[model samples]
Target: MSQTLRVLGTSVTLLESIRQRAEAELGIRLQYQVHDTQTAQRIAVMHPERYDLYDQWFHNLDFVWPARAIQPIDTRRIALWDEINDLPKLGRLHPDDRLAHGSLPCDRLFVQPDGRLGSRPGTQISMLPLTHNADSFAYRPEHLPAALAGREESWSWLVDESWCGHIALQNDAAIGALDAALALQASGLARFDNLGNLRLEEIDQLANCLIDKQRHGHFAGFWSDDREASALMLGPRVHIQSLWSPTLMQLHRAGVKYRLAVPKEGYRAWFGGLSLSRCVQGPIKDAAYAYLNWWLAGWPGAVMARQGIYIANPLRTRDHLSRAEWDYWYDGRPATEQLPGSDGLPLIDPGEVREGGAYAQRMGHIGVWNAVMDEHNYLVRRWGDLLRTAR
Candidate 1:
């Protein structure tokens, strides 16, 4: 009997295609456990036996690694090991390109002989890099005032008094704080010394500002998952909110008119990948390696490409994608022909241009990464308070 490889992650990585292909091709039974970022992080650290693999953003390392909940993956086991993008290896790119502010630092990506994460070159990694993308807010043009309809995109719009009671924000504390800080900085409400690793004072100031807005009816709601976010856009009718690329894609496919803003301040970037649970061993461990290898094999990357995420190894993904798909998704070219969504059904019509332009252009504008700061515990406490009392 095939052992079930229980995987825990946010909804983003639980793609139907990935599940179907892994079971059918790799011959492993998968049990996907989806949770919000915060909850998932907690479960992975405190309940390792419940899962065999953890797929989440790099910020998770701050919490998961110290708890010793996950084991480092041997690079040799990953079939595309050499093809994987290692920030340390890419000397030709600009410094910012090599290390975005909010992403995992190059020094902490590898496993040292002592079983701790370090920067030195090694055959083991904390996580196998999966998909990454830049994120920003989306808005319905029809909901904007005529004066601001075509105005320059700004994060300030999220907290703008003009849209009070018509806006929504993400429920995830770490990322939500980043978005709030960006808006605060853009609007001159407050400033942070480091937006990515927000200090306690900075968190308080920003959270206070958001709570004030909430008290004044500045928010329509907070969404915990993609479906909730999509529902907010369609039901209660949120005009603006922090959005994920997949949610934007879903809205577009449903014929909802929206535009993903290229905020003047820059985009909040994020990277996610797969990691092995400390409890996994023997056949389960072998199967986990197989699953990680499959992700880097190209087809999975191609499926993620349709959702606006780029695989860690771009060159390999080319083999699994059509010319038009590659051009439109990565090169920023207008679609030369109708394109398919992650489901392989036609979604984009010919001539539709991707938001934020090409991959290089979008990536070049990363202002901060989704991150867990030094004050994470405090932030979570206050964030919980905001959720309960903000109304």
Candidate 2:
């Protein structure tokens, strides 16, 4: 009866942050029940009422079934929902993902972003897309072929075979081994979903290839975090890492000389959102909504976009971006602070990527990326084995 909300989530760091914020701002306390993908789904079944809220992928993946299990939010409460007012959030999401947030908002939906505001809110205003795992090329400028310069009309270059060795791929085979599949996809090597699927064999082939390159020191290093990838670019002899775009953005600013590209072969994406448990009712609900509202407006919105995950709210401002942030994501900017042979880098900003579709809109994603995360062990292990024996 007192206002304590139990949130079922994946990350302890994220949940901890929420717990702290809830206590500080609204005087509410959130009790989080942590679960990885598999565990979370089971939690959805076993203790339907045990959780007041659930963290989910925004793409209507496995996490969405919980919504089917929970009560659909009724739009009849529009005014009660309208009580929260702050707007002008950062959106500029991929055009294709627009439907993801057509009707929802912090207004009625009980969702919040750890990066702040991720994907979209649902049509019924019940759910929110929290984050996006979008794939774009992360390359060092010095490593780019001078021939590919000025021809940035589309994304055919990454898969050209000519650009192979300089590439740094994600180490995990099954889950992280997407771009390899994407390479197969882009090159017409094999095709699956825009949000694709990979057979065990294809995954193995990629894994072996990755291992071969890795052992030979064909990479700068494996990137564990977006920021770490950025550091790799800014640090030593590493030229490219095909991880997340966040690191590329950072490297671009540090004068590291890099490029985050959208491949002609196409890029990959995976995103997640939030859902509230059915039996959740009353005061705790209000506090949750409050947290969501504050998170989507002003500074928080800008921070999220700058971090590289895509957003869904049009109300978030385009102007909120710092010049470097604007240049990195919106426009194609070089990675280093200086031209490879020059003393200092000039502020080079191209136009199309500036008006670019959101990653949520353009790239095909790993539907419910978290679902496949569990398979990563099998995937990585198999890939590693092939790398040793074959490649």
Candidate 3:
């Protein structure tokens, strides 16, 4: 009987190349279940037996860690533990940014000697840092009128009356709320004291604004999966919408011209990593460890870099890429030659510069990280109401 490891995560981590490579190299089969952020969190917490590992954003630690569904990962088990970026270890990427704003990587990341998750460094960690990057909306340049050429990009455009009924928004509440809040503030609709963790009243305000916009036909549609998001961008002709990096690459590869905006309010940053399920043991547990190590071995990171996702340990990925790939993806220079997407086919044209400039410049502009608010339950209920009415 062949060994199989069950993993649950978002579509980003379930790439075909990564899976095939792991299987071929590690001699284990992988059964991957894809879910939206909320659904993945629910499964990881409520039914830990269904998966051996979970890859998700740090914001979800609020729920999953309390449920005790995952076990601490010993740094010694990971092959390249020392090489991982210090941004998470230091808590803040830049001196000026608050610890709360940059994915909160320091809080509850390490597993302490007492077996509780904490910021103080120890032998164990809650998760193996994987891929992370800043997120922003994308728009079709040709759709804009010549009169508005070179207009500064802003999240407020999502709620602008000019694009009414032609805009799309993400379906997930945790992220969608942040995006909406950013837009609400940018558009002068309303403001929140803390965009990452909204108060109940602030949640209500944002939800009410979203409902009003939906009722007035402001949103063309809401998308949950990458395919649905891609459809919105390529078909039915959405002018602007919230986008993931991979989906933007998909649109670009398909010959659709789109521009990823570096919004004036700053980018929404996030960090994601892999966690072991409490149920994994014996051979399956060993296979899970192998898989995690394989993820940090550089090839997977190189594959993801094509889609604009940065790995936790960039030095490892450096070995797997050509100088040009490294320069174009990390240094934010114009591509000297055509570069392949995750599929290993040429996607980026020569001389095209990456949006948002270099990695440091991009990370420096982070306004807020994705987060689950203290009032997440209420936020979800209100978000559901908007979805139902919009549909």
Candidate 4:
């Protein structure tokens, strides 16, 4: 009899192709529960018994680990652990670079001897590093304001009054709040001592700033997922907004003239991985490990690469991609020819170069990582208030 493992996560990795491949090759039945970021995080923390595997971002580990919702993953059991990049082990792609702010994956990677999470390398880890990307907003050049014609791309444009009533933002507290704070600071409207961890007063300041903007019709709307963002960006409804990699790909396939900005202020980065539920054991636990190992085994990473996401062990994925694909996606070369997306349709045309150059070049300039802040509970309450009142 085939064992079954249920995975809980947002749409990032709960993709149909991944699920089908895992079921076919591993001989295990897989069930995926996809939700918006907050809903999925809540269930993973509050209802650990509902899923056997957790497929989500590393930032959520702040709440999930402390609550005992997920168990440690032994690195020895992961087939590609040895080949995983140093980014998760050292917090920086290179040893000399300063660590990016927020809940970086490396900071919570290793399982300490005291049974808590820490950076010290050990036999066990909090999550298996899988896919990641440096994210920034995408905009339609035709809708860009005249005043900003010669200006380099910057986060400040998200709040600039010239573009008021035409900009959309991601509608989550943790991720969206960071984007807002960056914009507010870039626009000289507000300041935060640490972009990653906001004090209560800082949260209030952000809330008030956004509230004032909403009252004046500065924002077009808010989006909870890439699909919603895609709709908002289509036509003339929205000209600029926070965007994800998959959404960028979708817009391209639909013939939207979009450019993923290389903001002067840098990008917001996120890393995603898999973890086991606290309640899983025996046969199910074994199957969970099997699924985790499969993600780093090349094919899945290759699929995500086509969508512009970076795998942990990109060298392994390199083998599965074409020469043109490897050059365009990882090396940041202009497409020598058209390139297909994960769906195997031409998504990138020749002569187009990736916005931010190579993998190292893009990942090097992170402004912050998505985080569960120290005052996350308070942030959530105020964030809900802003969304409800703004709408």
Task: Answer with 2 or 3, whichever has the higher TM-score.
Answer: 3
Model 3, span 9-98: residue lDDT tens: 989878877888888999889888898766888899999999999989888877888899998887888878888877677755578764
Superposed by TM-score, candidate 4 places the C-alpha of residue 50 at a distance from the truth, in angstroms, of: 1.3
- Pairs in clash, predicted candidate 4: none
Report the alpha-carbon TM-score of model 3 versus the true structure.
0.95
Best by lDDT, which number?
Answer: 4
**Which ten contiguous residues of candidate 3 have the minimum total lDDT?**
97-106
Clashes of each: 1, 23, 0, 0
Over the full model, what C-alpha lDDT does candidate 1 score relative to the true structure?
0.84
lDDT for residue 73 in candidate 3, whole number 0-100: 87
Instruction: Give the worst 10-residue stretch by lDDT in candidate 4.
Output: 382-391
True-structure RMSD for candidate 4: 1.1
> What does candidate 2's lDDT look like per residue over 55-95, in tens digits?
65432332344345444443333333343222201222333
lDDT of candidate 4 at residue 344, scale 0 to 100:
87
Candidate 4, residue 43: the lDDT equals 97
CA shift of 357, model 2, Å: 6.5
Q: What is the lDDT of residue 120 in candidate 4?
A: 90
C-alpha root-mean-square deviation, candidate 3: 1.8
Ranking by lDDT: 4, 3, 1, 2
Instruction: Tell me how far the alpha carbon of residue 101 in candidate 3 is from the true structure, in angstroms, after superposition.
Output: 2.5
The lDDT per prediction is 0.84, 0.47, 0.86, 0.90
**Model 3 clashing residue pairs (backbone):** none
Per-residue alpha-carbon lDDT of model 4 for 14-85, expressed as tens digits? 889989988999998888999988799889999999999888899989989999999999888887799999
